[model samples]
Target: MTTDLTAFAHSVFEAQPFSRFLAAELTDVGPDSAEIRVRNRPELQQQHGFLHGGVISYLADNALTFAGGLALGGDALTAEYKINYSRPAIGETAVARAFALTTTRRQAVCQCTVHMLGDGEERLVAVAQGTIVVAAKD
Candidate 1:
């Protein structure tokens, strides 16, 4: 079923203070997919002049979590996650695209890929996979 993914993303942003701190924007959200973007700011950079790994991982994780939530049509929490960094994120902005791979009554599995935007090359930065548990509204 189609869902209002933008509304759901906004609710998640409102509930997660750290997502606000990261300045993450939900660019795309559909029944089984979502995308988020974050501009590279000094605070998010490391001494090496590249985006910090943790920040990239966080964005990927959040994207996957949101995708899972969209797929489940309810609140969901990440039960496990894995990330692989492919390159340094040194661009002005990073974008992550997430999509659900599978879903059941209780869980959803999602994957996200992060890339540096600009140059139209869309070079890969990182990839992540997550399993999320659907939860009842509290």
Candidate 2:
């Protein structure tokens, strides 16, 4: 990613208060892909002591949107998405990786996978697919 684009992505991310509260990091934003990482915290866990499903979903959603936005080369918003949780997220950190699967003039289809990283290994926790459309300009 170009330095300008990287700055733009970070600025957009920093504008989200919820993401900041979660301590999420926009680790990478590229032409066709994006990545997000969040450190595990007790407040983010559920009854079973695993990362809450909402947290996993948030990571996937943001990653997919970022990928689509990058593919579109401008602002974009998620149209809709579906996610499947394969396993509990149990790790020191969670990582979401997303890529644009297809793109048109105004929209892109994106896929995302969320993983739990711990002890030198990563385990799949969730998968998601979403459609993103260019944001309407003011």
Candidate 3:
């Protein structure tokens, strides 16, 4: 089950140019969950040396959508989402993990949590909730 979706998930991630630009990698994906990881680079940081809010939002949005798509068994687009920043995000690495909160025939509610890895410990940085609209199958 997971093995099949693993390849599909990686393909979907690889096909996103923006994900590639941000160096976001799809680490895992299943019927109801997905995980992505990105390295902290200077170029991805804000003036305050924290990862920019936009970067965190990007992770949340994409991770949530990927989770929804897996649960829906096809493509989906982000309809809307909101992210709450817990603190200034600083670390050598960052991870976004998303799970389906609810799913319908054409839509899904997903939650994403962002974490920053520093000194071998992970700290919560942001949380997001997203609505995803599944695409019609051909």
Candidate 4:
């Protein structure tokens, strides 16, 4: 049976309570790729008045996992990941773009970049790489 992956992706995003609480919108999800966005707010900022590192990492991880699932045509979970923050994420919004860089039957390498969008421009904020493991069907 074929799945309507776009609908599935939206459902997955909606089911996540944290994402909902973060006010993240899953803008796009296709085979091997996905994008998410969140509006910047003071609550999401750190002591330095910039987007918190945890928030940035959260965006990358979820976006990458979604891309991995799209690539595998099934559910996937993050095995491990690493991220590097290049600058303070300060902007009116944050966008995360993720792609499945490589895929096997059961594993995928997902990469993501996050950008801060404000004042009609975007600034690169963080980069992440993750390994996602596709779960076997029950």
Candidate 1 vs. true structure, TM-score: 0.91
- Candidate 1 lDDT, 49-95, residue by residue in tens: 89999889988988898889888887788899999999899788899
For residue 87, give model 3's deviation from the true position in Å: 0.2
What order do candidates take by lDDT, descending? 2, 4, 3, 1
Give residue 49's lDDT in candidate 2 (0 to 100). 95
lDDT of 3: 0.91
Clashing pairs in 1: none
TM-score: which candidate is best? 2
Which model is ahead, 3 or 4, in terms of lDDT? 4
TM-score-wise, the better of 2 and 4 is 2
lDDT of 3 by residue, 1-138 (tens): 467776887888899999999999898787888999999999999999999889899999999999998888778889999999999999988899999999999889999999999898999999999999887556
As for model 1, its CA RMSD to the true structure in angstroms is: 1.7
Best by lDDT: 2
Pairs in steric clash, model 4: none
**How accurate locally, in lDDT, is each candidate?**
0.86, 0.94, 0.91, 0.93
Error in Å for residue 24 of model 2: 0.3
Off by over 4 Å in 1: 1-5, 136-138
